[model samples]
Target: MQVIPLKYGTIFKRAFGQPDVFCQFTKDILGIEINIDKVHTEYEYPEPIGFVRSKYDLFAEDTEKRIIVEIQQVKEDDFFDRFLYYHLISMVEQVGGYQAYGFDRTVYTIVVLTSTPRDGSINFSCAVSDMNPIDEYGRTFVVYPHRLVFLCPRQVNDKTPPLVKKWLNFIEDSLDGEMDEVDYPDTFWKKIMAAIQKQTINPALLSEIKDDAAWEEAKIRFVAEGVEKGLGKGREEGRAMLLKQQRETVLQAREMGLDEMAIAKLTGLTAQELKKITK
Candidate 1:
């Protein structure tokens, strides 16, 4: 059976929207117990200009902290910068409408990358203290502890914990060909698989998935074609520039009262080649 694309926004919402699933996901990423007060999907941050800004994949907050969960299938060069920007925006939105001395709650940004990064690390994390100096006890002035957690599905292996590995497998594996080969753990894997199966049956959801897939496919194709065209154009321009420089050199040599033979020796052009330019 074809599995739902977890990286897709609609499918991600359908598969993990359940409070139970989202809570489990939170714990798996944070490696700590969390009581989620509410879960919002495709949540729009408060745009001060009211122009409708970017929407997060998942936004959940509790009394102590707010979590932003995102699934990125394609890797970009400025991925870290983008996530940092998103993290800052999330923090800003907390106090957007209300006045406060500082953010009362911490912000956590969790990103699941379906693609492998250059370093091939399965997991990467960053915190404020890593970039700044702090004492052994840690800095007391830090109120909002913003963190970034990245999980690369391709790099998950036996060394990973059972539950974490299972969750990664569920998100990445299609479970189509080798059905009986791998035995997934009972709870989270089963819940996600069952939810995907159930959600796939909804005709509207299925249609939406198909449409989104088509749109994404078209986008990839367009980008690939654009890059190819750009490269071709660049090569053409490069050749033209080289030819112009060669011609300019020949003209410059002639201006200096040098014969065709001297120009040929200086520019590494044959006598015939020099004649072709002078002709």
Candidate 2:
């Protein structure tokens, strides 16, 4: 479509994880009046592999608490690993210079994730939510009084919940050069279009971007030369060497009474090919 979401958040994070994207969200998205007193990226806590060290997409400070925004594309089962790490990082402010090593400070972690669960089928494939949250003031809610929420696709409709309504639309759908009618702020829309235009409007960037999109498209082309190259590269010599090795393995497996499906899975050879070998 016309515009893509301002992701490359990972890319942007790589460039400016300390203060740019991290601070933008708190000030812009949350409409919070907080001055960024300090900011750090790749925060490390001296401990083991899973201990207080994490490279955040963006991490920063405000007047009251530390705001950590993690930009992720794919969702994994152990996603809470992100929250757990951020929880640890929040301890940094209180334990200034490691003196107060175990003090509890507030942290706001918002994970921007992939598409949402459509039709409210409870798609928790890549999400962890408090099966319950306390209403702060009807405008805000917190899960376990620590984290906020994950923004995904299905949360973008006119009637969807407010937390992700802006974010979901920015990523899934494109803007029609008209931002007023939409839900997200105009400045946020500008950031979105800036990301998309970087990948589309320029001649060279367009070639690269469209090539990325087109490569995913499947098309068939018959070519004798490709087949010839496949066959002619050490044709008989390599073939004899590997064929014997492969055939011997297949034969041994067959002798063990394994079925055709099992042999196919092991060798990546077609059932028909395995049958020919056996015969």
Candidate 3:
């Protein structure tokens, strides 16, 4: 009984897209609590004409702030650029008129990446900081509410917070189908496990997941085969080039009036081999 990867396409969306689960997850990652009623999952919004469609993993709006959660399985070069765009769009959608200036709400962006970032940090956070010349004077500076949090599961370690560490362990091993020894707070774990199990039991969904896994495996094998063939061809070409150089050396020695035995000795070729080349 193979378990579907929790980070893959639809399984990821279905597993964490539940209202209760996502809200709790938001709390765990950001250390902020929000009303469950405000959380919306798989929410779609209109994009510019002639552009691709847009959908969000989760959207939560409260009296003072709006939160957007994104789960990324694969890394992208323009990930931050796109995330800023989404943050801006979410802010734009909230205010319709110029008079709504002071009525703007704070926006928080959360991204969970299964792949580690290039800097090798386990967790990354960005915020609107107020720069000060020196902190020794105990001067306080105001910070903006626009913030971003990145969670990288690969880098989680003992230094991580207890709850978050346990949760990350659960997510990393979710595909193993062996949760009996998990030591997390049981209620939260059970809630999330139930959501995962619900989708895992669907026959059509399971088939699609299996097919995608097979395709990925086949693609990897195809790439490996191509690399192997390329190396073999390169080796053959190198051997052929060496042989051509050796033949040229033999001819050059013969042109210098060297005798058959002398040429054979100088070129390290047997008399019979030298005769074939000369003929």
Candidate 4:
């Protein structure tokens, strides 16, 4: 399949707005079906108390299976902690906190992460409660909505389970433009293309992405963030200059018999600033 990866914004729109894509993705990855019939973020989950809002790439669900999936793009540090927070909120919201029943209705928490690729670390790693920690067994802690499946594209391989393979391939191929057509679901190709076309549109952002035909121009755009940061520093210096001028003016006034309170009120200067003016 000729899979095309989505840009930052398009990810949210396509996943939530396109139910076919959303529903199939959930089923293929997490082995569950959602009522994609009516999927909306603010409409469904309705961010609750203490939930950190706007910290995720996608807050998704397969309502049929009562499943909620959050996609987090990991940058560094064990920021998975935030993903964990969102996941817990999702679970809490689903089961109505401490009041609701059936804490384990096969809830699946999935994370799709893109990072600077690590070799040797499997491209896909899945974690399930080690079923036998006591006798080499562990528990799933059925006290809340059931399972969590995280698909870090930086971690998968052919050895990955079938479902995860489809997802990992989706992410990998979409990124590199060399999609493994045979391995993915039939509809995967079309869904991805539509999302990408949507991204290539909006000529303004498109121009921003593709600007810099000259390598110098490209380099400047890439490091444009540093330029933006320097503007902050520049503003600090400008403010200092103005402050220095104000201090000098206040000092001149004081030497010429201006009252300290009068100088303070005129310059809107703090007592500390006024002291500097005098000194």
TM-score leader: 1
Candidate 1 vs. true structure, TM-score:
0.76
Candidate 2 wrong stretches, greater than 4 Å: 1-8, 11-24, 27-31, 37-52, 96-105, 115-145, 157-159, 174-188, 199-279
lDDT string for model 1 (218-242, tens) is 9778978998999999999998898
Task: Give lDDT tens digits, candidate 2, residues 1-279.
Answer: 344333434333433343544465555445454567555555544453443456665667655666677655442345656666565556544655645455453566667654332345445322434324446665444433344546555345455545445455655554232233245547645554554543445676556545634442321122345557778886887987887888998988889998879989999999888877667
lDDT of the candidates, in the order given: 0.70, 0.54, 0.66, 0.56
Off by over 4 Å in 1: 45-52, 75-78, 96-100, 116-144, 157-164, 175-182, 252-279
Q: Residue 99, candidate 4: how far off, in angstroms?
A: 5.8
- Per lDDT, the best of the predicted structures is 1
| TM-score of each prediction | 0.76, 0.48, 0.64, 0.55
| Candidate 4 deviation (Cα RMSD) | 11.8
- Per-residue lDDT value at 249 in model 2: 87
Order the numbered candidates by TM-score, best leading: 1, 3, 4, 2
> Candidate 2, 7: how far from true, in Å?
5.1
Relative to the unseen true structure, what is the Cα RMSD of model 1?
4.2
